[model samples]
Structure formats: structure tokens, C-alpha cells
Target: MVRPPHLFAALARGWLAVAVCVVSADLAFCQGADTDSSSGTVVKAENREVSARFTPMRGQWKPASFGGDGPVSIKKTESGDELIEMLAGDPITGILWEGDFPKENYEIRLEARRVEGFDFFAAVTFPVADEHCSFVLGGWGGGMVGISSIDGNDASSNETTQYKEFETNRWYKIRVRVDEMAVTCWLDDVEYAVVPRGEHELSIRIEMDPCLPLGIANFMTHSELRKIEMRKLNVESGSTDPAAVKVESKTEQAN
Candidate 1:
């Protein structure tokens, strides 16, 4: 059998191209398997190991109490997404979850939108060990975002203070991760803030104490909350020291 020289060269080039593509795809898949695209955290689970579990605190939230002079209801959007709507009114208006929730080494995620009013649309207060902290979004006149009452300083004056433009009626994804080393937050899947656990005490303001452990409150802002979830992170055993826990505000501390 006789074959043309050019045809043999062309077939060799085609085989080389296919080899290159296979190697490139394998490298990309290996990289993606070890990292989370949304949060930029490394995945610890192997092929046979089970991934970290996510516990649903509220896919559809029911309020323990609805404060303020407005209204709260579970409504479906035009796009068929279910959400809890809080109408604007008093100083605080929203739902509160009084049930038991994880206090450490966990992450909380939710979708929130400011439908009306001029204040914050999401003020999520959760426990950090024995203490508590609040992640405020679209707060302080709808531009400020930060954690409240770090070392007796409010979110506006704290080190995690940031300003972001939040549009009305537009949904934004918010996530917060609390661990022994630091408290990190992401807004719309972008890294927003990181507050390290150092000498500074982590505690909620006195006003936020009523919604302690786990709660969501809005200040004079009509908002909608949906897809609320909490996931426990796999922490190294014996990593937390109970004696190192600091309680800053005795008046607001949960009993």
C-alpha cells in the first residue's frame, strides 16, 4: 500500500491537535474540582468523601413576630419565585426566626431585594459562639454595608464598612461565613468584607438583641427575602477555645 506524503503529514497534525485538547481539558477539570467558583473556597471532599452538608433554615420563612406598622406575607413573584415581603413602616419591619440555629463555623446565604423605603433591606443577626453579629445590607440610607457593633463600634464606623449602590426591586445574593479565624461576607458572589477574629470583640448592638441567635430585620424598608439557607462547615476538631470567647455587651447577651 502506498500513501501520499502530504496526507501522512496532515494526519499527524490532526493527532497532535487532539492530544493538546485532551490535556487542556483534563487540567481545567482538575482545577475546577478542587475549588468553588462562587465562594473561592477550596473543596476538601475527595471523590469518595461526602461534601459538607447544608441545612435549610428557611426555604420559606415564617415570622415569629412581625414588628412595625406594616404588613408581612409570603408572595410569589412574576417569575414564580417565592419570597417573604415586608412592607415599610416602623423602625424595624421584618420576620424573626427564634428557633435554635448553629452558633459557629457555619455559613448563611439568602437572596434579598429592597422593594421600597430608604433604609436597609436586610439586617441579618446571627450567633458567633456565645456572642452575636449582624450583617447589614443597603443600610444607613441605602448605601452602606457592614457588620454592626464590632468592639462597640457600629457598622458605619467599623473596619468592614463599605458603600454599594443597591437598586430598588433588584434581587441580590448575600452570603456570610463565620469561623474561628474570621468572619467573611460576599455580596452577589463577590468578596465584600473580611473581619478577623482578634482582640476586637464581636457583638451585636443592643437594638439587635431582640432578634438574637438567628433573625432577619429590615429598617423602614420594604424588602423580600428568599432562599434562606445555613450550612455547617467542617472545622478541625479542637480548633475552638471556649475560654477565649469574649462577651462585650452584657446588656444584649443572650441568656
Candidate 2:
């Protein structure tokens, strides 16, 4: 049986529409949430360009006041680098991401440097499943570094604690990985803290309650931040797996 010319034309148009829809679905995931049974991770995609920018605008990212916090501003350095400047507070100061982010199997990266004062300058509080914990760098008088409130102990006393001398006005790359098994941190690619999740209860102290879900704070220290990024970790690098990127439609069964 030979199909009519009009029928062939209609089928071709339908196929074109289906192809466009498939491509759109893959890109649309960058703004939505999905889960893969293979990894059992709830991955939330994001537009990295917009998500990583720190312009200090309300609603996207806001300055946090943890008790008499100093002023927060954005400054462009001589090298054309834009950085978020957080002045030291009396007790604590920081900023919070006023947006939705991934809860598990995620990584947060940023560049930070201590400008003055003598305490934590790059402390980050992040989510772990339903609870939260903070990675303290240059805390407890500018040397202690670790994850806080592990099994009810603060970073100053947790099993993940370490001490290192940090010079003023020196930038360091910070990478934190939160996965199903552990919460790990590295400063300038040096592994500093690693805490397995199965045994210890991850939590934050009472003073850090305002920075819940996602936030950064400094304890009597001023600092600058650049190139802050938060992204999900389930997606493999250079992966072309159709199962994850392509969305199939019911075209063959159509009548």
C-alpha cells in the first residue's frame, strides 16, 4: 500500500516536532530536578553562568547578619577580577544563597582569602540530606580547619579538625564534596578534612542557625570571595549517556 503525499508530509512534520522536543528536554533539565535510580541521587541542574555570579543583589544572594555584621560589598580589583568583600563582624558575618540548591551528591567550589582579623574567613555551611554541617577554615584563631558539629562536637573539637597557618591576603581554592558516604574538603588541592557519614551526626551550632541550608560566615575576620560555584556531582564528565540526557517519547504507538 502506498501512502498519500499529504500523509508523508504530515509524518515528516510530526517527526521534526518530536526531535525538537527531545533536544529541548535535555537542556530544560538545567533548570529543574530529576532522579536516577542508578545513582539514587536527586540532581538539580542550574545555569552556572547566573548561579555563580555574586553581585550582592537581593533575592538571589543576600548578606547575612549573624550578630553585628559589618558591611558587604562588591569590588573590582586592578586585575579586572570581581570579588565579594565581607567585612569582619563582631561575632560572625557571612552571606547566604537565597535560592534552591542540591541537597546531596554535590560540590561547592570557591576562591577565598583573608584580608584582616584572625578567625575563620571561608567557613561554609551546607546541607547533608536532611541535616547540615559547616566546613571551618581558619577558625579558632586563624589556624583550625575542619567540619563542625560532627556528633555534637564543634569544628574545634571534631575528628575532622586540622590546623594550618594561613597568610593574610593570599587566595586559596576551596573544594567541598558532599556525597552519600562522606563529607570531604580540600584547600588548594590539599585534602584537609574527611568525615564519614554513617557513624557521626552532622549538624551546625546555634549561632549558625541563620545560615541554614546554604550560607558562608566569618568569625571576627574579613575576607573576599570569587568564582563561587555549586553543582551536582552525579553527571559524569564528558558523558553522552542517552539514558540521562535524552528523553524518549511515545511516537511509534501513535495512530
Candidate 3:
């Protein structure tokens, strides 16, 4: 039952080809790690060498036009958008901004800090409605990050996963991944929610708004923030995990 020498050589060559293909695919993923379509990955903006910045203001959209309800600044990049340096201890409701992302998934990254009086609030809003949108992921104080859809006509329904703690004055990183039929939020690399995509009309743009109230018990009454950033990654075809280059872990200490 011994195989012929030529047949064995052919089989060896085929095995070698398969090995080469596997190696090439791995390298491709490493190179295209920022993509999110095929995989669920969190890519770092700084790793991409994006050097963008903008200033902040109150009651109006920042020069970048990311909106909300508070005193804040905006920075937008080819990859995505950001808001930062939110004034703390103000009794205002905070702010909100919008970006229209059509029928595609996206990656959002931002930083937040809670100071003394009021708790800090950070959110990734999606499923944008006419006058409002749902809170796909958000955090208040040291509580778990909450997920719920909000609109002018519907009551909020919480998505199951939750991100806990998140202290004051310490900068924390937040990321959300939205794909065809699922949405997930992560705080410092820890996953909070991974739920089936909700039923809402797709809007082409996403708006970011931070609410700052000048009164007590408001979104930014006791919060301070900075270094707000965002980046975009084109997900690779037929991939199940996010494409990401291994940058230093932004969430390593949060756990």
C-alpha cells in the first residue's frame, strides 16, 4: 500500500501551499487589524498616527459641529469623531453630537473624567431618531455602563450587558462596536453588552452631544474631561473579529 514517489511529492507540495495560504491570511489580518466588519476589534487612534484637534464652547456646536447640551470641545478625524475637556461641576444637562453612518458598522473611542460634585456621563448614541436617538452604551458615575434606546415616542429599554465602577478624575476609555445585527460596548477592554441590533431606521450620520447642566444633579455637574478621540476602521470582508493592530492596551488597568 506504499504510495508512489511522485504522488507523495504532489501531496507535500499541496500541504505546503495550504501552509503558505494560512500564513498569508494571518499576516493580512495583522496588517488590516483596524477593520471591524469581519471581526470585533478595538483599534487605537494614536496607533494610526492621527494628529487632529479642536476647541470647545457652550450652548452651540463646537467648530467641528459635534453637539450635545453642555460646555465641550469637538475633534473629528477621517476615522471618526470625538468630544472632550467637558467642564465639571456645572449643573447643566451636558451636550450631544451627531454623525450619520449609513448601513455599516463603526468603532468609537473617547475619554472621560469625573471630578467632585456631579457624576460623569459618556455615551455612544445610535439608531438616531428624528429628534433623538437611543443610548446604545453609556456610563453614569461608578455604575455599570447602560444600554437603552431613547426616542421622542418610545420608553427606554435597557440592553443587558453592564460596565461597572469607572472612578472620578481618572481618565477612562470607552469603545462601542456596531455591526449588521449586533452592538457591543467595552470599557477599558472589558465587555459590557453584546446584544442583537435593535429595530430602528438607519441614519446616515451620527451626532455626539454632551449635556452640561448649570444646576445640581446634572450630567456634568461634577465632571471634567479631555483627550476625546475617535477613529474609523474599514472592516475586512468575511472576517468575524475586528481588524486591529496591537497597540498598547488602553484598558489594561481598568480591569
Among all candidates shown, the one with the greatest TM-score:
1
* Candidate 2: tens digits of C-alpha lDDT, residues 1-255: 101111001124434321111122123222123433332322322212222223222235678868799888866668665578899888888888888788876778788999999999988899988989898889988999888888899988866777889999999888777766567677886556666556678889888987888988888888988777765655333332211221112342252
Residues 15-39 of candidate 1 have per-residue lDDT tens digits of 4322111022122211222322332
The count of residue-pair clashes in candidate 1 stands at 0
Clashes of 3: 63
Write the candidate numbers in order of decreasing lDDT: 2, 1, 3
Clash totals, every prediction: 0, 0, 63
How does candidate 3 score on lDDT?
0.38
Clashing pairs in 1: none
Q: Estimate each model's TM-score.
A: 0.70, 0.67, 0.47
Stretches of model 1 off by over 4 angstroms after superposition: 1-50, 64-69, 75-82, 237-255
Q: Which stretches of candidate 3 lie over 4 Å from their true place?
A: 1-70, 73-83, 88-92, 98-103, 118-120, 127-142, 150-163, 198-220, 236-255
Q: After superposition, how far is residue 193 of candidate 2 from its true place, in Å?
A: 1.8
TM-score of 1: 0.70
- Order candidates by TM-score, high to low: 1, 2, 3
